[model samples]
Target: MAEVDVGKPLPAITSEAKPFWEAAAQNKLVMQRCRDCQAYVWTPRPACYECGSERLEWQELSGKGQVYSFTVIRQVVGRAASMAFEKEIPYVIAWIDLDEGPRMISNVVGCPVEDVKLGMTVSVVFEQQSPEVWLPKFKPLVS
Candidate 1:
């Protein structure tokens, strides 16, 4: 992992999401799973999105998925906040359909932005944003 851009916005670690961030720092991808319904929960919710069960536990994931949708960011949009990514204009942001059934939005890296396609297979790669934060970005999965 490389040093994060100082201008890049970092995630605020909430108690519910602390575990996920901690795991990412270890270069692992994990999500919460409901013990009662066997459903995977994302975004660090308080209860299962599927069965409304509060019996959730953190579990490691395969870190593999397919691009569900994507867009090439060619311009900086917002105010000061968007300027941080100005150097990374023309990056690809995509929704990935994980093998474990969760759809997560993350940046697709390790390849040309033009090469990204819908349903293209990808796997997780951590990018260190800070000592306690590592973002899970996706890259093209090599066979």
Candidate 2:
């Protein structure tokens, strides 16, 4: 995978989200799961959204999912922030429904933007953004 440009925006590594980013750096996908409710929690939240449980554990995921929804970005609107992605104007951003039961947003790559479709199967691919950060993008699954 190609490294992200230096000017591209990177995620802020907070204490709660450190593990998720760290796992990505090692080419693994992980999410927080509520020990009480057994529900997967996203965005590194301190409590489970389902049962409001404080017992969350970091668990590795299968990294396989299907596109739940998507949109093609054909334009760059902003000056500084958006310009960073000008070269990749036509890209697919989608909400992927993980096989383990969580919906997360990521870019769907490795194919033409027009080829992306709803319910398309996908798997994780990491792109190193910095020494400590690897952004997990997804690509269409190869059958």
Candidate 3:
């Protein structure tokens, strides 16, 4: 039921979060939408943020978004990130505002941090961390 870092002390997977992780394994992004207010929400709860209604369901998104904000990690500073962290140290991590109206934290890969900017168009790509798990990553949308 766990993906990424099977035996390691990290990559802890939980029951409440299993579905989201499972869906991501299929290269899909899932976010709960409030059935009452039709508002997109994150953290996967059974209620609406706008109307406080308990009617919610998970929906798949296009996985396209704009970078709201980001940081270029120039150093690993720890070993838990990855064994190749040194090589991939300088990476961009960002909060992306999905077209569905929810913002989620994720990493922006396949590009240099210097080129990353706020409001940059991006689309999703999946990296298989395990046979049953794929992490959703993003790349700049080329015009």
Candidate 4:
């Protein structure tokens, strides 16, 4: 990917998050699953949130979901984000409910915040900062 901004604060890409970011680069989503209970979870934990088992693996997920709850940010907290998105004031952020049951936090794009509503269908779109780095963002699913 090309660097859209010469110097911007990027989210720390940790070892545990590599797989997810790489998958996102390929337009895929993945979450952790517990080997013991077959329960799926997020945040790339060392153990299952359901069964408390350290046995886990990364599993592919369908990148389809709907907005559960959301907030429109008129004021961004960070200097870098504020600068990068100064023209894009009032963006919608939300907890999207994936079809497989995981709720992921992401920003809703391709539409105005006033148009963004609860239970609106959304799909993932990746923001590539660098060739090796990618972040998951989303857009409304339009008919």
Q: Between candidates 3 and 4, which one is better according to TM-score? A: 4
Show pairs that collide, candidate 2. Answer: none
In model 1, the Cα lDDT at residue 116 comes to 98
- Candidates in order, TM-scores: namely 0.93, 0.93, 0.81, 0.87
lDDT of 3: 0.80
Candidate lDDT values, in order: 0.92, 0.91, 0.80, 0.82
Q: Model 2 segments beyond 4 Å from truth? A: 1-5, 80-82
Q: Weakest 10 consecutive residues, lDDT, candidate 3?
A: 3-12
Off by over 4 Å in 3: 1-11, 78-84
Query: Residues 1-143, candidate 3, lDDT per residue (tens digit)?
Result: 55455432334456656777889878899877888889887786656778998887888999999999999888765665566556666888899998877898889987888899999999989887666567788899998
The clash numbers for all candidates, in the given order, read 0, 0, 0, 0
Residue 12 of model 1 has an lDDT of 97
- For model 4, the stretches where C-alpha displacement exceeds 4 angstroms are 77-82
Pairs of colliding residues, candidate 1: none
Q: Give the worst 10-residue stretch by lDDT in candidate 2.
A: 75-84
Residue 79 shift from truth in candidate 3, angstroms:
5.4
lDDT of 4 by residue, 59-137 (tens): 9887889999999888766674646665666888799999988898989988878999899998888877777766788
